[model samples]
Target: MSDTRLKISLASDRGMIDAALVVLGTVAEHCSAPLELHFLGHGLRDEDRDRLAHACDAHGCALVLHALQDEDFGDAVQVNENIPLVAMARLLLPRRVSGRVLYLDCDMLVQGDVAELFELMPQGAALGAVRDFYVLDQMRPGSERPEKLAWHSKVLGRSEVEGYFNSGLLLLDCDVIRSDRALMTRMTDFAAANDYRYMDQDYLNVLFDGRVFYLPQAWNSIWGRDRLRAKTLAELTWLPDAERTPATSKVIHYTGPNKPWKSQSKLLALLRGRLPALMKWRRAASGRYA
Candidate 1:
């Protein structure tokens, strides 16, 4: 029997409609379970609602929308320029829904059945997620920066290097999250008052700490891994060869500001978009020629 329980949640605002369309459209195309998307949008227009609903309906799925605003986050200071205020909306999503939910970022595309991740999830974690590239990069002695690691540890208020997980793709155990209201409150408060480089992402990592189920890197494969400074994939000795690209990744996350949807700009934009692709090729060719 087809699993009827998979529910995916995501957040975005009006400004990110184009990327939202791409992500939602792909989810509709690839999901194996009954499609139910719970979305949080701040200042969304009626026209945009129709567009999102259509993105789901195009593949015969349904979307339940929850309109959001800054006040929804209470005293939290919203000040990130690279992402919309709605990006923090996921912090409150567990209370809004029941059962397990897979929260996805709008900058990604689903290429396989994600329910497999739930099967892979271990017992007792409030959530499951892949470790961020920063965590992986930290494992490399040459790339390690004691000062930067210290900054992260200070920000997290915990020194667990493995605790960091990319918030882009989350498999949440809503019941567990709802039960931990005190931690949630403290995390939100800290995120509001402090300077966390990754914003709400850092807030979650700190609060969850050892409670997270470390997911396979394939489930949240980053398309443009900016942290990888190596000239070739082989030089990524810290990473398994299977993980260098989407060899088995079910979702391709286009992380950072330079999205495929955004039109090109100058130096910064150009480097974020093209350099990763070039490095992948150079790494492969160098191995072949050598």
Candidate 2:
């Protein structure tokens, strides 16, 4: 029983397998603590799983791959046009992993010691996450899409002042999560009945609602949002601070469709002035260790 061990969970569709590898490689490089990585994915080819096992072995981390079933999540696994069905696998993490688990989306690249986050648990909070600035952006007046923003309050059963949290990075107390069957049932039921713009994120906001412990923006800094700091400040609460730039950010969430896994030139264009940070993610995502 090593005190420094961190349990991590990741869920990916077949298409995002490479993205998963890059994330693991980056964590292997930067994370100072030991790790136990559990991956929940559907129909992963043997070779890819073998490769992931080898990657984890090289990093001195243990890896487990669980075959995912749609039925396992009930109606909660319903399709979302915005995200792959597998992305919802995070919903099952507490039931599957058994103890405290850190759930990270495959699209993210970590640069700091993840152990720091793994050790933190807010008093009496079921989940710890960063606030979703996109929620605030959409909720603001004068935004073109009123319908999307309108649901935040309706779905969460609270006002926007309570804040909506990003599901990309979560530090979950699995014991607490497993104890609450009603919360899980409600989230699944909500997912089945409603079509949400942000997919499982909406359900999580509704599930955790006011209970989420908000972590700092540096912990789950969104790539595009952090870069947009030069443009305006009012709507971007998720932006990383000047001192906690990409180099210092513990987690850089490559949110949205334009990812660093794209070709170098394309990434350069997409990231524009933020290429230096993009270069780091690109290198990690590509598995170019040299």
- The predictions' CA RMSDs to the true structure, in order, are 7.0, 4.0
Off-target runs (Cα >4 Å) in candidate 2 are 1-4, 75-78, 137-148, 158-162, 187-194, 227-248, 263-274
Q: Give the worst 10-residue stretch by lDDT in candidate 1.
A: 281-290
Error of 2 at 53 (Å): 0.8
Off by more than 4 A, model 1: 1-3, 187-195, 226-246, 265-290
Q: RMSD (Cα, Å) of candidate 1? A: 7.0
Q: Pick the candidate with the highest TM-score.
A: 2
State in Å the error of residue 242, model 2.
15
- Tell me each candidate's TM-score: 0.80, 0.82
Candidate 2 lDDT over 149-195, as tens digits, reads: 66777777655443688899999987887788887566445355346
lDDT of 1: 0.69
Candidate 2 CA-lDDT value: 0.71
lDDT digits (tens) for residues 159-240 of candidate 1: 6574578999999888777787786566446346335767788777777777888776767777755345333334556554
